[model samples]
Target: MAGGVLGVGIGIVAAAAAAAAGVGAERLVRARQTAIDLGVEDDFVDIPDHEAAVISDAVPLHVEIDDPSPGSPTRQPTVVLSHGYTQHHGVWHYQRKALRDAGFRVVLWDHRGHGQSEIGDPASYTIEQLGRDLHEVIGQIVPKGPLILIGHSMGGMAIMALAEQFPEVVSERVVGAGFICTSSGALSTVDFGLGKQIGAAVHRLGPGTVSRLSTRQKLVDTALRAGRDVEDFLVHRYSFGSDVPMAVVRYTADMIFQTPMSVISAFMPTLLAHERTDGLAAFDGIETLVMHGQQDRIVPRKHADDMVARMPHSEYIVVEASGHMLPLEHPEIVNTEVVALAERSCRAVDSGKRRARGVPRNVTDLRAGGRSRRTTKRAAAK
Candidate 1:
C-alpha cells in the first residue's frame, strides 16, 4: 500500500514534468514557425492595472482593454473575458478579438498568480479573493456599463464567487454572462473521465501527490524541460477533445507552464473545496450561456447540466467533440455564441424556460464546424 501511494506520488510529479518542461516546446516550435503560429502573440493594447487598491492589495491583477472598432455602435456593452487555471490572458486571444470586432469593448486580465500578474499571498489565492479581484477590475475598468462577463474554468468560478460575494453587481450590473468549460463546484468529484472507482482513487491521491511535487520547484522545473514529447501528449490529452496542431498543444502547455508549480499547488485546495452553486442565483433573470465540451474530461458535461438546471433560462451548449479547452478548440463557435449572447443580452434576453437538448429547431448542428443550424450534429445544452 505504501509503495502504491509512493508510486502515485511519483507519477503525479512525472506527469507534471512534461507540463513544466520549459525550453522544450517553446524552442522546439519557435524555430520552425513565427511566435504567432506558436500562439505567443501579445499584440493587443495593454494598459497596466495600476489602481492604488490594486497596487496595495496582496497583488495587482494585470488588466487590459480592447476598444471596439471605431465607428461601431456605442450602445454595445463592454465584455470582460476571464481565463481558466494556468492560462494567462492570452487564452482568450481569439475571443477578445472576436468581441472587439463585433463592436464591443473587451476587458481581459490574468488571475492573481498566473501570467504576467504578480503572484500574491498564497493564502490570498482563494476563489473568493479572485472574485474580489474581478470586482476590483470591474469597479475600476468598466464601472458604469451594461456588462457581459465571460469566464473559463477557474475564471468561471471567480465569476460565481463574484456573484455570491456581490449579488447586487450580478443582479444589477451584469446583463449577460458566459460560463464556459467550468463548474459551480464539486470539482473534487470529477474523475477526468476515468470512471468511478479509478477516479475515486485518483482524487484521493492526486492532490497531495501533486502538492508534494510542487514544492520541489527546481526539480519540477528541471524535469519540465526534459520531456517535450511527453508534455505535448499529456497536455493534448487533458486539454482538447479533438486533434489540434502540435503548435497549439505546446502553446497551451507553455501557458500552463508559466504558473510556477508552487502557485499551482497553492490554488489547488480552493478549487477542490469550491462550492458556488448559490451564486448561480444572481443570474436567474439575466441572459446566461453555459457551455462545455461533450468530451470534457475535467469538469465534464454533468457539471454544465447541473448549472443549467439551476438557472433554467441560461442557454447551455455542449459541443459534441470539444473538450476542456472549448474556447481554444472551437473558437468560431465560442465567438459566435458569445457575440450572439452579447447582442441578445444588450436587448435584455428574457430568462425563459430551460431549452432541452435535442428537440430540433433549437439544436445548433455544427459538428463539422459551421454556424448553420442546418449542420449535421449539434451540442446545445438544455
Candidate 2:
C-alpha cells in the first residue's frame, strides 16, 4: 500500500510537469499567432516611442509613451493606463492598441517595484504613493493635454488616490476615467474564493506572513515553479470569467507567476488596509465608468455596486460571467466603453472651449455671425 501511494504521488507530479511544459509551448505559439493577427510587426513597430524616468516619492518610475497615429492632430487627448498589483504595463497591450488606433496618445508605466521601475522604499508602498507617482507621470509626460485615465484593480485604487490627493488636476485636465475590477474599501473582509474563515485568517495574518514567506525567496520561487499547474488553476479561477481563451489565461498567469514575492509582500499590507470611499467625491461631475466582473472572486461585485452608489452619475457596467480580469476577458467591451468615454469627453471639452472663447451656443447664431463677417469684409473691399 505504501509503495502504491508513493507511485501515485510521483505520477501526479510528473503529469503536472508535463502539462505545464505543454501549456508553455502552446502559449508561445498562440502569442506568435496573435502578434501576426494584430499586425504588431507593422502597426506597432513604428509608433514613436518615448521613455521617461519620473521621480515620485524618491522612486524613479519607468514610463513609456506611444505617440498618436500619423497625422493625428497635435494636442489630442491622451489616455493614461495603469495596471493592477503584480502587473506591469504590458498587461494593457490590448487597450493600448485600441486607444492608439483611435488616434489617442497612450501612456503606460510600471508602478514602483512592479516592473522595470526601481523599488524605492518598501515602506512607501502605499496606494497614496502610487497616486503621487501617477500625478508626477502626468505632469512630466503629458503636460498641457486633455486626459482620459484608465485603471484596473490596484490601479483603480491609485486613480482614486489621485482624485483625492490632486483634485485640482482631476478637474483641470481629466475629462473621463475608467475604474475596472477594483474596490474602494473593506477589501480585507471580502471572500477571495477562499472559505470565509480562511479568507479572514489570511486577512488577519497576510502582511506579516507574506513578509516572512518572502524571506525564503528562492525556496518559494522553486515551490511556485514546481506547482505551475496549481498556479494556473488558481489564476484562472480568480482572475477570469467564462470561456476565456487559453492563450489569454496563460499570458495572465505568466505575468502573475513572474511577479517577485517581495512585491506581493510589500503591497499586501497596503491592499488590506486600503479604504478610499471618500475619494469618490473627487470624481463628482466628472465622466466616470465603473466596471466589474459578476464572478470576480478577488474583488466582488458588491464593491462595484457600492462605488456606483457613491457616484450615481457614473456609468456602471457589470460583465456577466466574468472574473476579476475584465480587461483581458472582455477587451472588446472594455475598449468600446473607453472609446465612448473619450468621445464624450472630447465633445464636452470642445463645448467648454467654445464657451470659454465667447462663441454663441446656438448653431444658427454662429452661422449668422460667420455670414455677417464675410459680408462686412466684402462691403469694406467695395
Residues 264-323, candidate 1, lDDT per residue (tens digit)?
777778888999887787887777888788777777789888888788777766676677
Which number leads on TM-score? Answer: 1
Best by lDDT: 1
TM-score (C-alpha) between model 2 and the true structure: 0.78
Off by over 4 Å in 2: 1-48, 71-75, 353-382
Which digits, one per residue and each the tens of the lDDT, describe model 2 over residues 1-382? 0000010111122223435446464553443343234321212122337888998878889898987667755436788999888777876777777777777888998998877788777788889999999999999998887898989988989999998889998988887888988889887677465566545544555555556765777976787678655555445555765555556656776666566657767777677788999888787767778877777777878897788778776767776667777777777777877876776667767777411111111101012322321111111000
Please give the lDDT score for candidate 2.
Answer: 0.68
Computed on alpha carbons, the lDDT of every model, listed in order, comes to 0.71, 0.68
**Where does the lowest 10-residue lDDT sum fall in candidate 2?**
1-10
